[model samples]
Target: MIEESGRVVSIEEGAVWVETLRRSTCSACSANAGCGQGLMEKLGVGQRRGYVRALTDLQLAVGDGVVIGIREDLLLRSSLQVYLLPLLGLFAGAMLAQWLALPEAFVILLALGGFFAVWWRVRGCSRRGVDDPAMQPVVLRAQLAVCAMPVEDR
Candidate 1:
């Protein structure tokens, strides 16, 4: 499971809005200084705050802290869906256009058409609830003080 802790910014209809600090991998690497990512970081673009919505079982309220997790399998599937589908669509369109000996402009348009088609298909699937459950992040545990107290200490 991939997990992150965030403060509960709001709670509504069984969903919790969590605000978390976003960190970049560039900061940890030695080559950060010369890289684009590092340059952005140096320009005060690092450590931005981001928010996520998590489906929760616990009764949570605003100002609460919580831990949320995405299952590994779900994460993998989502990653593939978001990244691979577009690439596949672009390649397929390019290949078909090439086979037809289409003009350069037409080829570019076809490629973009393929990419957008896949994007639209994915959106339709999302609306149809094909991957809804797997895509949603789950609230793993409430970060209440009581829960954090060790048994021995308690």
Candidate 2:
């Protein structure tokens, strides 16, 4: 359950739209004068993004920073789908090629080419900040982590 904070920019029933800040610790570091991180941060201004999500708590409002987690099950399932689905497609295509008496080398090359093309497309989407939708029943792990902390710490 990775969590990051954003400003609650708006709200609707069971939802809060938030704008996440592009936070880089390098911005405030004394060594920023010598670091590439600061240089990239400066170049990547406006990297911040907005996303709307369901909120059980109605008390939160605009201008308030809220933390959100990319749901774990959704993350895991999406990774599996991205990695495995194309491989399955390649296998099916290869089987057809084999039955059609295509040369073994050609079949193998087809599988490899298909795999690379799919992987490349998925990578491009990920790099562009395109989000995969979450499966239902998102259990909030970060909230549970906070609750499970010992009483003395609280």
Candidate 3:
């Protein structure tokens, strides 16, 4: 259950809009006073980005915690369509071209297309966390702490 928080920017016609915050952990840095990462977070403070999604039958308020995701079946189908099929197509095309004495240019183009197709799909899929309005990783695991608490001597 990934989670991210946002202020509902709008609700209209079976859709919800939200303005989200980027997740950065500059506050805990030991050198925050001189760190570039800390500076960026501070400079970008209070900035908001918008996300819009079709409202589902489930009741959701404008300010609700909206966790969106690619459903498991959708993900599975995408993996097959985007990755495996493209690879198989490329290999089969390359071999068939060799066997049938097809032009080298034709074979190269098909193989390149297949490779690009897979590259594009993988890039988008991995960044689902950045672009998807519904899926948030923060809700799943943010607070399993490390290190022991300090003891107060009596």
Candidate 4:
């Protein structure tokens, strides 16, 4: 399970809306100083904050801090859907276009068309909730200011 801390924004019966900081991994690598990812991070190219609708069993309230978790398997599958399929489509489309001896411009267009076609299908499948339960995040536990352990034992 992958976990992150978030603060509850709203409660709706069985779920809670939480807002968390969108962490960037660019800084973790030694090559970040000259990498395109580091440049994008410096420019704030992506979202700074992220929202999650997490299923919860606890009595959570607005403004409460909580830990949300997502299954690693689900994350892996989602990564593939977002990254791999389109790549395969691009290669297949390019090869088909070459085999047919199409013009250079048409080849590029067909490749892009193939990528978008697969992307559109992925979007539709997600909207139809093909694997929502596995993809959805779940609230793990409430965050506490202090741990239950006694202090000054050292």
For model 2 the TM-score comes to 0.50
**Which is the better candidate, 2 or 3, if ranked by lDDT?**
2
lDDT of each: 0.85, 0.65, 0.59, 0.88
Per-candidate Cα RMSD to the true structure, in Å, reads: 4.8, 10.2, 10.3, 4.0
Q: What digit string (tens of lDDT, one per residue) describes model 2 on residues 1-154? A: 6566666677766667766666778878999988887888888863667564644444665666566766776678778868886787688668867888899998997777767777777777666654333432221322212336555753
Error of 1 at 70 (Å): 0.8
TM-score of each: 0.82, 0.50, 0.42, 0.82
What lDDT score goes with residue 74 in model 2? 65
For 24-136, candidate 3 gives per-residue lDDT tens digits of 77888889889887887889863557564533444455566554433565556556866786687678667767677879997887777756766676667767755454442
Candidate 1 residue pairs that clash: none
Better of 3 and 4 by TM-score: 4
Give the Cα error of residue 28 in candidate 3, in Å.
17
Candidate 1's TM-score? 0.82
Sort order, lDDT high to low: 4, 1, 2, 3
Q: Candidate 3: RMSD over Cα atoms?
A: 10.3
lDDT winner, 3 or 4: 4
Q: Which residue runs of candidate 4 sit more than 4 Å off their true CA positions?
A: 32-47, 147-154
